[model samples]
Target: MASSAELHQRRSAAVARGVSSMIPSYVSTAGGGTMTDVDGREWIDFAAGIAVTNVGNAAPRVVEAVQAQVERFTHTCFMIAPYEQYVAVCEELAALTPGDFDKRSALFSSGAEAVENAVKIARHATGRPAVVVFDHAYHGRTNLTMALTAKVMPYKQGFGPFAGEIYRVAMSYPLRDGRSGAAAAAYAIGQIEKTVGAVNVAAVLIEPIQGEGGFVVPAEGFLPAIAAWSRAAGAVFIADEIQTGFCRTGEWFASTHEGIEPDLITTAKGIAGGLPLAAVTGRAEIMDSVHPGGLGGTYGGNPIACAAALATIETMRELDLAAAARHIESVARPRLEALAAKHPAIGEVRGRGAMLALEVVIPGEDTAAGPAPDAVLTAAVAKAAHELGLLLLTCGTYGNVIRLLPPLIISDDELDRGLSLLEQAFASSL
Candidate 1:
């Protein structure tokens, strides 16, 4: 392996500046729940490639599947020459995702692609042109998705001419909104009814647990109400589970807890155990709304990615990762809440299952008021973690949320180690 200094220099010189890397550009080796730098420095990985390594890094099953697929064949393009692995992954999605109704699945290369395609299927099926989103939601970077997303600075800034026909409504961020589920739903519906006209809306897309918007779990009954509203309005309910799906949120999908059978659900990240694969699974009738040539891509469902996804689904089943994730929530949430109490700067600690975040408030830690958590404190904690051999990510529309998406495969000791580092980071920051 190359030296960290040389590797970092090469990365800065050659790699595109468009992408932002976590600290210590060189992670020497990665496996299971940890990564190391070329200098033999180890780091506990909590970010998990933004929830892509749910089964953990270099998982045995995933590696075996990918290695075997490489030996046989790589790509033939599902549009031109369909493969079994792709179908198998779809079959798994149909089986795994919650819902009693018949389902269908379509594959894509990324979360954003899957999101965009779900909207397509919804619009085609409903014969409507308008789509509704929520405030503080982070859908994707594609033109339409960027428009659908609520954040504006990083993902949206400098990106012009975002696709149109996308509308947004306020979400019940209990920390901020301080409203009941019915009130929040009514607020959102009133906005759409007054502005977009529900008849023209094809879909109402949402994150079961708002991921980039600081992992805000919407007030209870909110999702079910929205699902009912979508049906009443004759629009498809598209759950943008890209961040909350595939056993990351305790359940197989976050929406399962609310008992909402979405007309369409977009998923990615953990679905392939780190490979580039995404899927849109929902009612077969809605999925088949589009014409034969309307859906698909050159490498939408590459055989290798499909194989990896198949293995990932199987791994989730055999290992019972969903139960493991709930176990994580059971042990982690109280500890995090305790940390929040000790570190007054932490404005809030919220989320479900393994998907959670701590909002770093400026003066909120020490005093009752300060500039509402604007990126300053969270950035400090993230950097502090980096120095202490830990990788983390900062999110939120305000940029003050330290969202934790640790690999679901982390051992109990490793999880404690990571949490200790986090406590120390906050302590030092304070």
Candidate 2:
């Protein structure tokens, strides 16, 4: 097999410059919480393909399902010939997503597509134009999602002239904002009423736990408050659970943690055991408002992907991965907290279940002068971890947060070793 170096040269020649990889080593095989590179080196995986492979890479059931599906059929285009697997997947989504009322689902190819369709459905249902998002939120890379996104660098740098009527408000970032959940919600609601006017608002879109925007867990009561306001204003409340769904946050969905039921929820990443499948699931009435033929794509709900999703969901239920995620939190969070106590650079350690993060910052003395984001230190720590054969990923609007998204199925030994390597990385970097 060609080495990673040789492959890198070819990739540099062929792939677009805009596309980037977290690590240089190319994978030969991956499973559970570890990945083997072409050079025969093994690395403990802490980033599950940006939270995609929650059931682990190449899970047995998912593999068997995909194989069986490939032998039977690949694609007839659900819009053209339709398929049982597609409908089955949708049915599963309706049953799984957060709502007791009659729910409906529409599948798509990627998270971005799911988000776009959610917004489209919200606008159509509410008959309004303005969609409200929050600060430090990341929806996706598409045109409309870029408008919905808050960060400018990398995701929306020069891709300007974005879609219109997307308004942004302050998010309940506890560490930085220092506002209680109720206070923050009131502030955001005030901004919407003052600037966008509740009458013109179509949707209030937000991530339950902001993913790429630093895994900023909104303070308690924040999500419920926003959902209440959206309901009172006759707006569709959308929870972008693309990164935090599928038991990644210790629940089937993060919104459930706060007892908030969004009118619409966009899910992807962990939904299909790494296969590209996304969905917009919501109340039946709202989803049906878009009329027939308005919310589908050519490759949406591919049979192989649907099969993978079915197997993925089954594995999650059978294994009780939601509890597995909570167990991971129990094992990892204390270690992370201990590390923070030892290193001042770790300004804060936050997140839930397997989705955790360390916000790197330049230490400060007084409360008035809050900690400053230390992106340089964050990058150095990640690089050192990579050299130690531990995979890591960094995120945040300021690019100073090290987010840990280990597979829910990671073994205890593997998880401990990964955390040890991370400790060593921080020590050497400091």
RMSD of each candidate relative to the true structure: 1.9, 1.1
Off by over 4 Å in 1: 363-371
What clash pairs does model 2 have? none
Residue-wise lDDT of candidate 2 within 67-172, one digit each (tens)?
Answer: 9999999999998999899899989988888889999999999999999999999999989999999999999999999999999999999988999999999999
lDDT of 2 at 34: 99
The TM-score leader among the candidates is: 2
Across residues 313-403, which tens digit of lDDT does each residue of candidate 1 receive?
8899999998988988887898999998887778788888889899877653332223366577789889999898779898888888998
Q: Each candidate's lDDT (Cα)?
A: 0.88, 0.95
lDDT of 1 at 320: 91
For candidate 1, which ten residues in a row score worst on lDDT? 362-371
**TM-score to native of every candidate shown:** 0.97, 0.99
